[model samples]
Target: MTEPPSLKKEPIGRLISYIHRTQQKRLSRSLSEYGIGGGGQYSFLKGILMTPGTTQDQLTCNLKFDKATTARSVKQLEAAGYIERTTDPEDRRSHRLYPTPKALKFQPVLQAILDEGNAKLTRDLTDEEEDQLIALLQKLNLEE
Candidate 1:
């Protein structure tokens, strides 16, 4: 692909944003059949699957998403039969999330899609380049 003239000196943040938008578009198309949303909804599902009794607040904090986004994702996942939420025994006001049978069965498929998406992102880079890029990106993740 040829770069646009205006992007030659684009800031690192802008470049990262471009990559994120492009990847999200591709991922959304790939995930359309599963009804998993594009805006980090899969992250929420994966998080719940990994930690079966996690709360919305925990997901919000860990995933760096706002409370409303987490709540919406949770609701969507629940509606799609991918997850369930029960009131926490210790705290009635809080709900604990768990993946449903459907989600559990879909776990491997979900992971394969995610893996393919990531692989596509780095397909143009050599192995060493990929490693270096990952390390550099990690460095930019100052808050996490």
Candidate 2:
């Protein structure tokens, strides 16, 4: 009997790439509608929302972003009126990041956009299939 082709030679990587490309395009368009660029903006907002008054170093470690990247993103978000940086009282050298009321106001809209995108991506999947896929993904993040 002939052996089947190796999994490494299969089209899994291409399929994954296509999925990521399509999602990126969709998210890019959706975010553009809100006048926001993708990437650091989203994470910055999420970080501030999750932990108000978090220091820049804390964001760097929590988001796994380099110090310069975190600093730049925070600055951009602050300039965009999405966040504010206040001096940390305990530490004169550090600044704590906080989301502005303007940023909080868009939380529901952002959530709706994300939900819609998720729905579109999972349109053909059953509840059980979705659960299984989520479990598989969680399994991949063992360190989490």
Candidate 3:
């Protein structure tokens, strides 16, 4: 009897990692056009835009980032005039994050870049194929 071909174990992780790295590089290049650098800053900005007035702890949980990294990103964003922190009225000891007008102004540029990236990533895929891919990814997340 003929033997079936064996699948390589390493290719799955390696392929996924390579794809992630390439996407990050592309995103970094896009962000650089707007004077922003680093993945953390982009992530923080996205999170703040999604949940204005979010606290540091809330950001950490939402982004799955550690406290130190989130705090550093927040500090850098604040200094860059992209975000501001206000004391929570209910809890003076805690601060809430909000995007500055400067940051809001960049929303269109950021959204354009994201839309372009999404278009490129799904360029050749049919709607069904895209849906299947998304479903598979969701399944993997559920497994986690």
TM values, all candidates: 0.92, 0.78, 0.83
Q: Candidate 2 at residue 104, lDDT?
A: 93
TM-score: model 2 vs. ground truth: 0.78
Clash tally, candidates in order? 0, 0, 0
Q: Which residues of candidate 1, in runs, are more than 4 Å off?
A: 1-7
Candidate 2 lDDT, 3-104, residue by residue in tens? 987776547557767886787678778877666566546777778888999998998988887888887878878888889988989999999888889889
Looking at model 3, report the run of 10 residues with the lowest lDDT sum.
135-144
- lDDT for each of the candidates? 0.93, 0.81, 0.85
Please say which candidate is ahead in lDDT: 1 or 2.
1
Clashing pairs in 2: none
Q: Give the lowest summed-lDDT range of ten residues in model 1.
A: 2-11
lDDT string for model 1 (64-126, tens) is 999999999999999999999999999999999999999999999999998999999999999
Which candidate number maximizes TM-score? 1
Better of 1 and 2 by TM-score: 1
State the lDDT of candidate 3 residue by residue for 1-144, as single tens digits.
989999867775677788778877888888886766775678888889889999999999888888999989899888888899999999999999999999999878777887887778888999999899888877765223
Prediction 1 global C-alpha lDDT: 0.93
* Model 3 alpha-carbon miss at residue 82, Å: 1.0
Q: Predictions ranked by lDDT, top down?
A: 1, 3, 2
